[model samples]
Target chain A: MAGSELTNIKSPRVKAARRLTKRAFRDRDRSFLAEGPQAVREALALDGVVVELFATAEAETRHADLVAAATAAGVPLLRASGEVMAELAQTVTPQGLLAVCRFVHVPLETAVTPGSTLVAVLAHVRDPGNAGTVLRTADAAGADAVVFTDASVDPYNGKCVRASAGSLFHLPVTTGAGAGRVAQHLKDSGLRVLAADGAGELTLDDVDLSGPTAWIFGNEAWGLPEDILALADEVVRVPIHGRAESLNLATAAAVCLYASARSQRTAPAGVRRPAPAG
Target chain B: MAGSELTNIKSPRVKAARRLTKRAFRDRDRSFLAEGPQAVREALALDGVVVELFATAEAETRHADLVAAATAAGVPLLRASGEVMAELAQTVTPQGLLAVCRFVHVPLETAVTPGSTLVAVLAHVRDPGNAGTVLRTADAAGADAVVFTDASVDPYNGKCVRASAGSLFHLPVTTGAGAGRVAQHLKDSGLRVLAADGAGELTLDDVDLSGPTAWIFGNEAWGLPEDILALADEVVRVPIHGRAESLNLATAAAVCLYASARSQRTAPAGVRRPAPAG
Candidate 1:
């Protein structure tokens, strides 16, 4: 392996890693590719899902720590040429490194149990970028978990994995669950379920967000379907005090989650916690 | 006009409208294209900037209100076939409608003035999508204006225009000015200048934002230069409560701006307003 480097894009291992770029293939293999240094480092830090890493000689030199970490964790690090690495990474300017990892999402029960403090649920979110951004936002807010409902995009989609930065590996995620089930779980776990919708009667400012809460975000275009909105205990909207019509999904989610984090952190007592219905 | 549908993508007028898709051509022609129904409607609503409209027959029927709006505003509406419309719009699924409009950025002095409450400045922000999303976030936060510095991406770039939703037309925007001049303008206008950075010594939570303020946001990859950061009265970071390394540009901007909105709205006795420096 000293003088030899993988140069053929169609080489068996290279082809195998490239296949993970497609959603159907990813699902079949239960694996996906994490591109760039940040994502690869985070996946390696997991020390579990990462099966192997492909790096150009330049990337190997640039990311020696990642190579050492992978080595210490018993993960194989393959050396590839620029062309081979480009074939494995989706970005226009390939970062010359990538990781093949098992799906990062866990089962719904394993993601968040009873009495969870903060949560974000993607209900019918279709855009890969939006889904990933929301996940990153949730993680930054210290959310216990993020739920990608049946109608949401695959978390392992190449664009999403990149958009999430390293946050994809930072927190627990539950995917392919139904929105109704997610809402019920949050409610049963003693958290108030809030559907974030543009047409919601209550603005985000109107709520006491210090409570243990799970927020359900809807489709980028049409927003949450009526049934899903009904499952939430309350429908809340991020206030738009200007002439703009509405906030995009990720910004809206951030405003909502950050409000919850600030409020929950500064609450004078436990008084803002939600009470069960009679 | 009912039978005069433009079916050829390269026909004189069609090609002219299509040319706006390229930034150089747009600048030379002093025009840009706003795609999709939401953007087209908003452009028509401006009663200015809009030079003409291109539509497929199906779109004219589907967007009857938009057609009526354009007709009533005396803006020229040209019918095109779906294929021609696709050529004129960059989206994979074109909405079959778009607007040819002049550049939208206003002169700097006219965008904001003394006593302006909230403002956002883009310094060295190169990504068109990020720039547009920040513009939209600022709009939703009811910011007085958005300034795109000389180093920032052009606001008329197709992706930026689309990402801005309709916010491009909702409020005043200043573009192509130097960041230093913009910061000085904000200071002279009696507003606090805050730079949002990941490594700022002051977290957003540490400052009182209930006052007239202007925020300078840096590049997606590198952030602000030392000279630019030094120009700010206070450098601020949105607190990351969890394991995420950092928030994306748009989400961070939203968190900061919304915090200011909430603080300024709820401030009593105007006590949080900043005092002039010695």
Candidate 2:
């Protein structure tokens, strides 16, 4: 397996995979690439999400389990040379394994159920890394859903997917809705919508968040616009105790989501497991 | 004051500034360049921090207040052409201002005072962006001090300084110390030391952080090594309520620091101000 596959950077399959790097092509095909063993494994774990798997011969040997899993799931595995993998990979250094997966976003109605305790709505967020980070943070906080608003960076962006650290598959993600529409949807789902803005009326310490809630986080530089802030049930700011002007967007999201997670303490959803007893 | 000055990209000043990009050179000169108007302005706010300032004609006109500040502080001002500004700048597009400033780290004893309620220890964090964001988050959370241990990235790293968004000048930062020594220093200062590791024994929810607390965070990838974790009074994990594996380093730092800030509720340090009684 290590020496069999010939290098073919110009192959049609490779060319097709290469096109997914752009958002337009990814949208047209309704598919995107998940690079590295971690993301490939996560993609394989989800039902019908993974369309195909690609790995270098060396990687195929090193990650036989992923190859085996793909085979078991009836997903075809393509063994490519390092050169081909380099072509398929978006990173400067390709990790030798990548998966082309179907878009996994659910509709807003399906993303947030009535029993949802917390949700993170990324509205007007432009940075892919920040968007992905907040997605990971939301999943860690056990938010029921994460919404990427129309103005937000595509969840399928390569950098965002990598920054998510396999969290792209962990929780429900709803996309393409506007901030006001997402807020309304969350409100309709019986969740209190709170906008996290620097000019918010109340500080995080002064707010009560123990109920079903949705947090709206905005762009990294200019926070939520006035119209989006107006739709929220309340606007809250994370208190700043030093001379720093503001908190980073993802950091702010983590603080808000965890505060809600702390207050809610929903057990069955999952918590970071404790160390095994001695 | 502006257009009259010719750009000398090969001049001793520009070449010397360029060399400061490397840590060895920065340490040798006991100085680093703070680029952009925001950073330069913050550096000017501190006495003896700003040694000299460089600007292009356009930027000088745009930020006359900064020029006034530097003039009032008696700091040398150098006008340069766009080419010279680009030569000294680390970013792809130069922001047209740069300040060569002295190292700002304090000793462990000076950084974490007796009455300090919250502190952040970045033990072996290697990513400059993560380190810088954590520093900014620590500042926003009203942390008393932020420490960059021996294995940590240099706070003077160009990316770290920019990522800090001027919070680098807002708080006390102690650098080049080992994690264990820093831990001992915090313990001796009457603060409880908690190391944040994925394998941490107690979850944040199960712990009490209301008192004087110092949080130790490790490398982005491998987390804290065992020897360093053993040095902490306790190892705490932020709960991951969903299927996500872990939180990002900067995000974890934010949650932990803000938790302490909320519990401690120090009034005089200045919270991000409320909307000015509008």
Candidate 3:
């Protein structure tokens, strides 16, 4: 509401939005792009998370509710030309809405406090799409947080932000930590750290997931190395019951996290179903 | 081994391979392209599936074992130039090998026999990646087969083939059929037909997945239409216990199919854990 119509694509505000596309600029500004109406709406819902809102004149009329909500939330809404919006947005057909939001991730120490029932740890995950899907899956499963090891893809990457489908705004995500340190931290917080590997000794069904647990996933191409696998309390695999070689990273994470979610929701207190007979 | 070196990118074999990139060409020829060593290797393992194998001269030396296997299998292995190979491949850096395989999908009737315990039905799924991932997930879960309804993307699309990770060769996939017809056929096979919807009366946990079942998944954007959801015996939602709105199509399919796989594997015949009290 305070900002004028930003028609020039080279304007500082538009340039800033474009800069957020790179990891260096995002880290420096501690802000990232949340594009499309759904993502922007979700970001606006989070108090103080949305720093600035940009909408093309058409988008303002099309998403009147979102514009009104952003205005009511005291977010500075900047009107931009279609060309300016297109320059700032990633999609082939720009959705006409973009939000610059402060990094919503909390410190790992604060997120993994006691009573953290479920968490997802991604180690050396290089694909932004997989990383984002895992984050979305983790959020859907009610995980307390997600931690990306130092070698993982930037969780704020444009493709990742798009793949997350707005779930990135729903939960705390931590990045740039070592797998060993993250594993130790989770274990220190009284959570069982389980590494998901293709060749694990125990099947996912064999694990007791009702207690506080940290599910560790690895890279898409090459999975967790031996050293990282050793950091977990146990290594488990989602059983490949058929001829297919393996599940994709995100699907594997979904199965693992949902299994834990189902178990924790059903099992009474610390009691869980015994591992099924092989 | 019998074919001479093909240095020209305009050779008939290379032209045919290039044409397979289009759906119309693939359908008319009833052949699809399988790129990379893993996919080519898997294609060779299936007797008579690999019609023609092409490799760069450098690839021939690198993949001696594959060449030997193909030679022993009596498949015509054509040697091509790097330029020809690059033109044939979709990747920025071609893997140096490609295979033309006849469509391996079988008749839906044969796939949905009475003995079939688990199957995946995808209706109106437009994303080639999501469709392929679902196929891979179904295969990994040991489902009997996967069926893509009429509106679905061609399962043989290059992106779909890549996302399937060779699982496309592992199981029978049926396509170009109506959703209603597929649903009716599955029901007639004495399998419980369950439609997966984000908004459904029953959660996936409440369903009896231990029995023979056909799980139906909808499109990536707009989910299953009302008519399709109405055709199923029951509509079940994967429980979203967190703030995330919904699971991606592929992840939702993995969760559903694996739930069925785990249930069918763990539960005794006609006996399963009672639905957890919610």
Candidate 4:
């Protein structure tokens, strides 16, 4: 635990980051792992966040710019052995750089908004990569928020964060309890809930997605649960013409979210007018 | 390879099915890996194609129905240690079973009609999961085919196969030398090429997707190369209404493909009849 303060975290930070290897440790600490120079760079790019950056001496030597940026930003930079980096990293080959940052908690109250808003809701989606991709898509589609229902994989899971391609830092993503309550809040706020079902009464195209809408995508093993499906004001299917069993959950969510975006994007300018041009 | 000539694989033949592991051997022999009781059951469900099956003694004792089904289907079976099973299987946790079946290449040319065929032209999509998911989406959307441009991942990669969720077997997927030629053939077949771009002139809703169109989705990194973009008769985009950077490739493809499906699905039945009622 030498040089362990926030200003300098070498072995201690590496040891802490390594604990992320177990799901229990990650959950208990409310922290997860992120690796590779790109992931580290993105993590550092976020404002006002405390970060523990671990890099090999070789990496520090070779990528002086990265080290300088980390130092300048006041992020705790740690020198770690390649073996330690490998132990802490998920990839078969560690990229000689990793970051441990606090998980940003987006309050449900903050996520709720009036007027036309788009949000993505995940129900029982356990795969970290799928959850992360959904959040990334939500951000790309300009959704107002992302809500993860109970039993969904932790959005801050290392795999999910990495899968998000750094979009996790850019978006307001909230997990844990109150997801259902938040969904209801959005309902009360006038956003229609549309659950995506492989089999549903309405095709996604048939539904007018231009209005304030929340799209629900669920586990690959099962579509949205029956209760969630019942709660939705509308259940829509992304019309499938081919012979595959079903679209991947993440891909399906992206399609539905983008479909909403398409509808909003193509709305007549007169209809989509900003409030008196500010 | 005992009972190699047996038309119906029974209890006696089960002993002969275990030896097909080495990649060099699998490649030289034109056979590949398959796993899971469900997957094996699925393989047996198909008419008369099971060459051999392998299962741990535990699986044989526990899932008697699976062994019975394999026996009924005349597929040979082999018993192996759990360690051997782990080495032979692609997934980290062995499903206590494996299979070595002759590779069935779905001809790129098969079942394609020149008039009004819709296909996905995948170019340089290096991620195996993305490639497989795209192919699977193409299958689910009932597209005529999926073409892997030269730089795309090998469709046969285990990850690709796992991601495709068995659609790779049914979908008319082709790669390598003939991919560009196939694109040319698709164009000559009167299929208009429409490349998908993050930044493009026509949004998905703006474009009339109801036609014999080949939707081109590109690599995760650079997107559709300029040369490939130039080949397209038109360039189409999925409108981004959110603050996110870009939609994932498979998601983009799904949106385009589903848009096409939606347009075609809503068209008068007489306009495009179902292919001979299956």
TM-score of chain B of each: 0.95, 0.93, 0.94, 0.81
Clashing pairs in 3: A1-A77
Candidate 4 docking classification: medium
Q: How accurate is candidate 2 locally (lDDT)?
A: 0.87
**lDDT tens digits, residue span A1-278, model 3:** 54678999888878988999999999999999999998998888888989889999889999999999999988889999888988999899989999999998878898786668899998988899899999999999999998988988888898898888898888888888888789888877878899999889999999888888899999866878999988989999999998988888999999999999999998885484332232
lDDT, model 3, position A87 = 91
Give the CAPRI class of candidate 1.
medium
Kindly list the per-residue Cα lDDT of model 4 for residues B67-157, writing each as its tens digit: 8888777777777667666655778887887766666555556534564467887788889888888888888888877787667776656
lDDT of 1 by residue, B102-203 (tens): 888788888978758899999988999999999999999999999999989999999999999989998999988898888888888888999999999998
Per-residue lDDT of B1-278 in model 2, one digit per residue for the tens?
A: 33356477788878888899999999999999899988998899889999888888888889999988897888878898999888889999888899999999999899987777788999889999899999999988888899999999999999999999898898999999877788888887878899998888799888767677889999868989989988989999988889998888888888888888876774443432222221
Give the DockQ of candidate 1: 0.79
Better of 2 and 3 by DockQ: 3
lDDT of 1 by residue, A135-167 (tens): 999999989999999989999999988889888
Top-scoring candidate (TM-score) = 3
> What is candidate 2's DockQ?
0.77
Quote model 3's iRMS.
0.8
The interface root-mean-square deviation of each model, in the order shown, is 0.8, 0.8, 0.8, 1.8
Position B129, candidate 1: lDDT: 91
Query: What digit string (tens of lDDT, one per residue) describes model 4 on residues A1-278?
Result: 11432322355655677787677887788766777876667667777454677778777777677778888887778777777777778888878887777767577656656644688888789999898888888887888788877668888777888788777877677777544676687677777889898878898768877677888788888887787788889899877666666788888887888778777776776554232211
Task: Name the lDDT of candidate 3.
Answer: 0.88
- State the lDDT of candidate 2 residue by residue for A4-123, as single tens digits: 564788888888988999999999999999999999999898999999888888888899999899889998888898889988898998889999999999999889877676899999
